[model samples]
Target: MSRTRRTLIWGALAIVAVVPIAAAAYSPFLAWRSPVYIVAGFAGIIGMVLLLVQPLLAGGYLPGLSAYHSHYIHRWVGAALVTAIIGHVAGLWVTSPPDMVDALLFVSPTPFSAWGVIAMWALFAAAFLALLRRRLHLRFRTWRLGHTTLTSVTVLGSVVHAMLIEGTMENMTKTALCVLVLSASIKTLADLRVWVIRTRRFD
Candidate 1:
């Protein structure tokens, strides 16, 4: 990890993480869409990008940040992730009440709706449990199990949800982002080795 190499790696990651959202911003779909819908769509795109960062931060794979700072940023990133999701859903609800209702009720005819709803709930659940883990007196193993399980559900559902839709985002960039996100998440989870973990307080 020489300084130059680390800089290159971080720069590449930044480009990859930012490209899809950048491409989406120029989408012709915006011309026909309401302003609220456009913002909602970008919120979803930003949320997907944050998913790529979350695991990289958790696993300390990014350059320049030590464990403590990385974990500290991870917490705030998680909060931003939640806010992005809320904005996405809230804007969508405002743009189309019936569609939002159908999606929320899990009875939407569109397949992606169900996946997005499931992922949204799983994400909220993971955040909620993390926030209350201390209050709940959860053991390390218990917390790890619940967190990872919810994470897998969230990743799986979100990738499927994003992939199933043909929206403002350019398809190739979206696919690349999705693949990176899934790969990063799977690698980080495998590295955790939760069953053998030592209950260290790195977080």
Candidate 2:
């Protein structure tokens, strides 16, 4: 493709990807919600957006960024994701403590609640393992396997949880974003192929 054509094509693709997210952020259903609900809803949106970025960074797919900077930003973004998850659950808790407790205990009436709780805990576990990698003296293969497993669960659960909730996010956009996030995560894992190669070597 010619340089100008390539630039225009990329720009169009960016717009197509971003407009839905922006529309979801300003979803009409969100307009009159209480502060706590609003905060929780937006936090969830941020979490979904972060989910998409995380794998892209890890897979080094984002253009114009060096591998060193991509990895560095990935770590920082991981921390930010933790904060976003906390804000999401905490805000919901503030709005309804009993419901939050029920969700955490895995007895929530809502189907989505269990998935969110699962993802939240998995996120924590992933971060904890990453932090203690050196101290635990884990082999690279083992650490990678465990980390990848937890992240896979986290992404899957998070996407399902978000999709099940009938909340502020616009349905079409939210679903599109969820699909993108899941695809990005799965693609990243497949590209890494850490576990696949390890198994092949053993076999």
Candidates' lDDT values, in order?
0.92, 0.83
What does candidate 2's lDDT look like per residue over 1-203, in tens digits?
46687677557547645766678677778767788888887787888888888898888877666878888898899999999999999999999899999999999899999999999999999999988988999877888899889988899999999889887778888888888888888899888786653542210
Can you give the lDDT of residue 100 in candidate 1? 96
Clashing pairs in 1: none
Q: lDDT for model 1, on a 0 to 1 scale?
A: 0.92
- Candidate 2 versus the native: TM-score? 0.87
Structural similarity to truth (TM-score) of each candidate: 0.97, 0.87
| Model 2, global lDDT | 0.83
Best candidate, lDDT-wise? 1
